[model samples]
Target: MERVIVAGGGLAGVRTVEALRAQGYPGRLTLVGAEPHRPYDRPPLSKAVLRGELDDTTVDADWTALDCELLLGHRVTGLTDVLETTAGPLGFDGLVIATGASPIRLPGDGPQHVLRTIDDARALRADLRPGARVAVVGAGWIGAEVATAAAKAGCRVTVVEAADTPLAAAVGAEVGAKTAPWYAEAGVELRHGVKVASVERGGLELAGGGSIEADAVVTGIGVRPETSWLEGSDLTLDDGIAVDERLRTGRPGVFAVGDCAAWWSSTFRRRLRVEHWDTALNAPEVAAANLLGGERVYDPVPYFWSEQFGHMVQYAGHHPVADTMIWRGDPAAGGWAACWLTGDRLAAIVTVDRPRDLVQARRIIAAQKRIDRSALADPAIPVRDA
Candidate 1:
């Protein structure tokens, strides 16, 4: 392909272009993004950005050496014979869909802040004044992180969750509920099993009766694949753009990666749409290879990490496909890990402030070999040897 257009000028798009050139595709590459700023890291937006510890999270890259055309502030609008953008129509021999996901906003919102961009973080940070009452809707990763930063900023923070516990939808209730204490320890109020009816100018209205008064309100209800532009197209859109093992969509010459893609995983025997920083960082290489006519399979053991309440939470592999969960240590302790297994083989791992466990589990999980259950359960033993 002479011309390749990468939609969404985020981390995934940047990596896709870099991968294309690294794979020796000497062609015209164009990076398009909705944001006006250069590609930047997003994980710190909820942490360091909000804490005012970091002013910029721009990705360290020499765009001049990449030799690709940059289209900032250009949003992909549609696709047909030619790719449509906010700028104008553009023809591409190959297209990489990396438009990523958008944060879900609260319904009937008033002064609702969602952190998905650097600008959003700055705006939210500005309102996080000392003693400012902050009511965060949702107890997920984003909500927890926002609460952590707000609490650190001396704001009276409270997290509201519709589920039984924080991260109930991600990790199971038993494991997720264990983290409820962290909120109280961090001096942030944790309210579970309550749905937010609406967000007003001051605070959130509970689904039941009472209301929460706050100086600032933020929602972390999760995100949806940004595929509105592709809705009119013949492209198959499931939870996201449905792609095969090679990250290629049914549409010829079009590949979907990043958060906006739900690629079939041969490893898990199902489709996975990983909206994590790790996915955007690694998936592009395979997508780029396949886009350049390389028949590379894009199956991966999904991994993601989150920082909340003074804990470094890391997870690797897909636990939903696993059958058993074995704890390495007590969750009440400072550092602990849970191993998800399919029979005797490792399927996933969840580590809380246990970096070494994650590093070891990742290597062992990639091997796809069975281990002794007793050995794996023992925290003192090496996971690699398990």
Candidate 2:
């Protein structure tokens, strides 16, 4: 490819260029970023950035050495043979769509915030002063992390969740409920089985005919892929831009990765669109290889990590709904692990404050090995041995 134009200069887009160069694909590279700032790390936006532990979380890289044109603050409006950006149309021999996702917001408005960018985190942090009443909607990863930061800042933080427990959709009610007490321990009120009807001037209106008075409301329900610009294109778009195992879109010279791409995982035997840092970091290598005429299937045991309420939580592999959950240690204790098994075969694992279990489980899951359930349940037994 003579000119490879990458849209959405987030982690995936930046990594695409990096991988292209690393693979010795010498060509004209252009990175079009929607934000004015250069590509930066996003995981810290909720944790360190919101807590003022970090002034900036820009992705540490020397762009000068790479030699690529970066168009910041340029939003892509449409796509065809050429990308239609806010600046102008630019043609490409190869195109990479790494637009990522945008956070879902509440219906109405208050002093609302969503943690998706550095600026978003900064604004939320400013509002989260000592004694400021903050109501955070959703008890998912972003919600929990933001609540932790707010509580640490001495804000009166309350988390409202429509489900019965935190992370119900991800880990299920039984397993997710184990994290409920952590909110209280962090001095953040946990309001389960509650829904926000609307956000008003003072605070949030509850669906159950109640109101939460707060100085600020932060919504972390979820995010949708930023693929509206590709509406009229022939590219297959489902929950995200649908791509095959090779990360190639239906379009010949175009490919999608990161949060914007729902790629078929041969390993998991399904299509998955993961909105995590590891996917953003690793998927581009496969996408860039394919873009440069190499056959590399993008099948990986998905992994992600989160830090909330002074605990490090990590998960690996796709835990199928039907998989039987096996607990390694007592959840009542501080650290534990829950392993998902498909008839003794390790499918996935979720660990809280147990990095060793996560590390070992990742390898076991990747290898598709079967382990003794009895041994796995024994906390004394190492995961590697199991």
In candidate 2, residue 212 scores what lDDT? 96
Per-residue lDDT of candidate 2, residues 184-296 (tens digit): 99999999999999989999999989899999999999999999999998899999999999999988879999999999988688899999999999999999999999899
The sequence of per-residue lDDT tens digits that candidate 1 reaches over residues 17-101 is 8899899988898888999998898999999899999989988878888888999998989999999998899999999999999
In order, the Cα lDDT scores of the candidates are: 0.91, 0.91
Q: What is candidate 2's local distance difference test score?
A: 0.91
TM-score for each model:
0.98, 0.98
Count of backbone collisions within predicted model 2: 0
Candidate 2 off by > 4 Å: none
